[model samples]
Target: MNFKFHHIGIVVNSIEQYEKQMLPNKKVREVIDKIQNSKLALYENFNESYIELIEPLNENSTSFNSLKKFGNHLNHLCYKVGPFSELENFMRDRKWIKVFGPVPAALFENQKVVFYLNRNSQLIEFIISE
Candidate 1:
């Protein structure tokens, strides 16, 4: 019954490109460098959680090439919660379309996250941390 809306993912041609065109005078480069040092940076009333910034890793990655295919838009938003299985069970009866990831045992020890694409325009991610 509790969750924190972590961050929103916006797909752009490039963060640098967006920063240059949208925020011409701001010291965006310095801000980005500071962020690289801390991974997550809290701004005004929002927290920025960066996965990777320089390239399109997968077909699903938001980058110049990928965004052209997916369309420049908000890719998704992640919410942090406790006990993903319990959340899954609770939401199951409500008819949400659950797709991909409860990453099974592997040497990497990655936690599972769930994505649900419903009638909503945004892809929702349930981030489960161990």
Candidate 2:
């Protein structure tokens, strides 16, 4: 599988506040600090691996919905993986069952990613960086 532990995704209420509070500790590396759309803002921090803060822009956003339901908690765990096809087959063969994409990702230019939900409802995000 060659899966490398990537990041822990967290849903937040405000990106600006979160960035101010967390981004300046002098230990973490900020890979991306971007407001992707009205629905999302992505902040990626790398201390050893990564930590992604996803702030919601509206009630209709995934982050808002998740924070409403789960209260600004750990949303998902991502793993850097190989090509999409191989990982898709690997997960399918293991019966993990894909719950989200093999779609174009916002992480990097031309990056593709996917999500698999195991029996425990634990999410496994796979990123295929190009």
Question: How well does candidate 1 match the true structure in TM-score terms?
Answer: 0.58
lDDT of 1 by residue, 19-127 (tens): 4444223232212222112112111222443322232334443244536677546567767778877778766866677765654311113346667765664567776
What are the Cα lDDT values of the candidates? 0.49, 0.67
Error of 2 at 6 (Å): 1.4
lDDT of 2 by residue, 1-130 (tens): 7988887877777656666767543323233323333233444455557667776666655456678888768889988887777887887787898876676656534377787898888877888854
Q: TM per model?
A: 0.58, 0.76
- Model 2 weakest lDDT span, ten residues long: 29-38
Candidate 1 local lDDT, residue 13 = 49
Q: lDDT for model 1, please.
A: 0.49
lDDT of 1 at 89: 72
Lowest summed lDDT over 10 consecutive residues: which window, candidate 1? 34-43
